[model samples]
Target: MNLVIVGLGAIGGSFAMRLMKQGYDRIVGVDIDEETLQLALDKGYIHEGTTSPEHVIAEADIVLLTLYPGQIASFIDENKDHFKQGAVITDVTGVKTSLIRDVERLLPDHVDFIFAHPMRGSEKKGIAGAEESKFKEANALITPVSSNKEENIKKVEQLYKDAGFKTITRVMPEQHDEQIAYVSQLMHALSVSVVNSTQASPDTLLFAGNSFKELTRIADINEELWAELFSMNKDALLDSITCFEEQLDVFKNALVNTNEEELKDFLKKARLQRKKWY
Candidate 1:
């Protein structure tokens, strides 16, 4: 199948490489950056590369949108007419509610847009940072609206399976947003706060342990991309933050009151819950 990957950044580029390794050649890449497109070609992640969506979108059997939420909607709105009839379009966008609503409304009837988010990534950006191993044994969430065709949804599920994801889950768009707000967005927010809480000296960082480094790894984020994600899912993210703050308050009170039992209970509960997660 001919595939078109929009936005040749880390996620997109990694998808391209994995798909190529699976013997699905004829992959084309689209990006605003000419340098990135050339790099994708040089790395053999794509057989063809173009700076304009209109140039290669029509020929794609599957169009994988790996751009930010806002950019994905805009690209679909502007180039929906060029999409091949019966072509399946999927995305790697983090947030989905507003994006799905907008793109589905503007999408032509001949083409289908099935929203999917691969639950894997690094704290790095661009094609240079793309790694095929990121998708190995990772979970993927496929969010399909009521209007989505059943066949198209299955095709998207298979797409992720072929890309090396270990698990593929199906969820409604709003439910996906709510869950991701807690599991994904909240962690990024916490990481940013932890990194910014103090202006640590280089020597201080040198003395840090694995826990500190792991917790703050995502703090080195892409501001422009994450800003869009945080804003688009503001309500859910804020709710997660409020819930987190309430839990933190309990710990604060326990420490302030010198309640050893309460502190132990909190730590014990956390360890038990985390055990269930693993």
Candidate 2:
């Protein structure tokens, strides 16, 4: 029942905290960020913290990685062989295809690798952003290949549930990436674009309406990490962006032609569609 969580940022820190609160106390955390690791230890999110991946892996029955999309493969390439035999491994990386594909090829047969994405996080970063209930009511997509050990898959699913997540199993990594691109990555790019576009004069900023502010609030983004995710899932994200651009262009044309009827119809349809999700 011991767990090692790598990269103790927002998601990892929150996961560790929730587990400790639930009395799963045998947790060791690993992060390259010294300040974040110290913060996790200080906040009692982790019983221990270290920079050595091998040290952390040696002690745990399960490992949960919360590194960026690009870092996941490199971490596997460098450390998969060292993981304790039969250890259940999983991740919180947003993009799945690349990491899942690489793990399938590189991971030893004895160590199990299951992929997962907890479907929400704040735009905020670091241990300061960690909340014990962050995954409450969040959709955690559990991905286990056919070759994965059935018992281990169940174990990982239980882990997510124990951490307060509502879990859904998704077998195909490619399908996971396609869905995430539209639901997560594309929305981030759209928010970033709007925020950047609206950076006019300060006087113009003061005149912004509530709707404008709400729509573009997520534009305050972590560009470096998101850029990696966007590039990793380029094809899917490009298709999403293109589809959205086409619709936005339709709106643009409506505004130029003073087509109030079409604009109203579009808004009404959008409202109805959004209601379905609620």
Worst 10 residues of 1 by lDDT: 196-205
- For candidate 1, what is the total of clashing residue pairs? 0
lDDT by residue for model 2 (83-166), tens:
888898898878877777777888777888888888877688887778999989778887778788889888888888888987
TM-score of each: 0.96, 0.92
Query: What lDDT score belongs to each candidate, Candidate 1 first?
Result: 0.90, 0.84
Name the regions of candidate 2 deviating beyond 4 angstroms. Answer: 167-171
List model 1 lDDT by residue over 41-153, tens digit each. 98898999998878688899899999888888778889978998899999998999988878877888899889999999667889877987769999999998877899999
Pairs clashing within candidate 1: none
Error of 2 at 31 (Å): 1.4
